[model samples]
Target: MVDTMALLLPFGRASRTTSPSAQHPAAGLPADDEVLLDAPDDRLGPALVAAGQGSHRAAADLLAATRALGRWDHRDRYVLRLAAFARSRPEWVQTWYAAAPDDPDVLLLRAQLAVDHAWGSPARAELLRGVSPLITAAARADDRDPVPWRLALDHARGSRAGHTYFGELWEAAVRRAPLHYGCHVAALRYLASSWHGSHRECLDFADRAAQDAPADSLVQALPARAALAYLNDGCGPGVPPERLHAA
Candidate 1:
């Protein structure tokens, strides 16, 4: 078997509980409004600005365009930014969700938001447990999209799920996008966590994934991420100098 477990990788809604500023809650957002997973695309910048101003149209349109174009990688990054925007400015997203309850973009954003919210809570595993259905619904919304499966892997890791379950998620992720960097990174984190201090196993998984993935694929840098992780934690044997050079 190809060790289906070798690959895997890994947002929330806005709420009205508190506002940084009643007039412009998102004022604290970056001056340039740079989003997480910053891609070079110019399209998303306008969408984020519009969302901050309480209009979901640009955000919705951008996500819709990404989905229509089958730009899964861009779609994934867009979802994270949109979800983060919602966290600070929930009203627009709530409106969007209410208007298009079943739109794949809407569903995916909602799932991302839920997971993001849950992950930050004091009760992480418990909060993540409740977000399971959202992730499932998002995954089912577009079976060909691996983004939801990526979220599922993150959820599984947050919930500290068993290997068998994560393996199933890993299979689903790679089946859709065999070398998705997000999923591969999630799997690496899981290995790092579950086998805590087992830097060799984590490096092994990362090296194999990086080797199998295309040169242009972000997955190719996964081994470097693993090396950095080991270096950061200063755990176990040092990553072989050869491996660092190869990465």
Candidate 2:
């Protein structure tokens, strides 16, 4: 597994009452992305269970996950929070991973989580059926090429074999575009599969996208390139082919 840089989340949300399931007042509540976004790791909110100090195992686990997410998305603080929660209670990984917004870590994360959860083909199918419309509507409305491309990449990586299966649509999704999301990730995957793209070629793709692609998309595409290098073919580091977030 690629060791993604730990993403430091803002903090855990506070409410007087904790859930019985969570074992603390902040238990079962969504994580605080805003807090993580507001400051660096040393400055993360105190509301989070002090390092090694949660009443419930879940709290500690969640704190760990958010801390893990500190370096990733500035926008999906909620997601970082969820990541912490999943680390605490791994069973929740699938549900929350699927919920991750279209961003750098989420797409690959959902897939890894789905695989970890053994979501199976049927589950993959169910998810694809649901997201297809959203894609269709988005494509019709948004002129931006990367949006749907991101969605397609999400579908391919995140599908379940049985429970969440979406069949060959994953492959088709990539082929249908105006080279949306560009082909960097796919290229990386192709290269990883058989060393298709030259290292310079992969870097060039990332360079073009970084300059022209939406700021948000650059995050997703970049990590995907990392996955291609590592997971797709077991090539390199946890870092994105291009490190956009840490910059």
Best by lDDT: 1
lDDT of 2 at 56: 30
Residue range 1-247, candidate 1, lDDT tens digits: 2385553322222212233533433665753333333333588777776776778899889988877777777788778767876886789889988998988888999999999999899999888989999999998988888899889988988888888888999988888988776777778888884343266778888878777777798777887888777778765666678876776
RMSD to true structure for each model, in Å: 4.9, 13.2
List model 2 lDDT by residue over 115-190, tens digit each. 3233245566565656655455433433333334444444444442221232233334334442233333433333
Whole-model alpha-carbon lDDT for candidate 2: 0.37
Query: In model 1, how large is the Cα lDDT of residue 23?
Result: 49
Query: How do the predictions measure up, each by TM-score?
Result: 0.84, 0.31
Candidate 1's displacement at residue 141, Å, is 1.0
For candidate 1, the C-alpha RMSD (Å) to the true structure equals 4.9
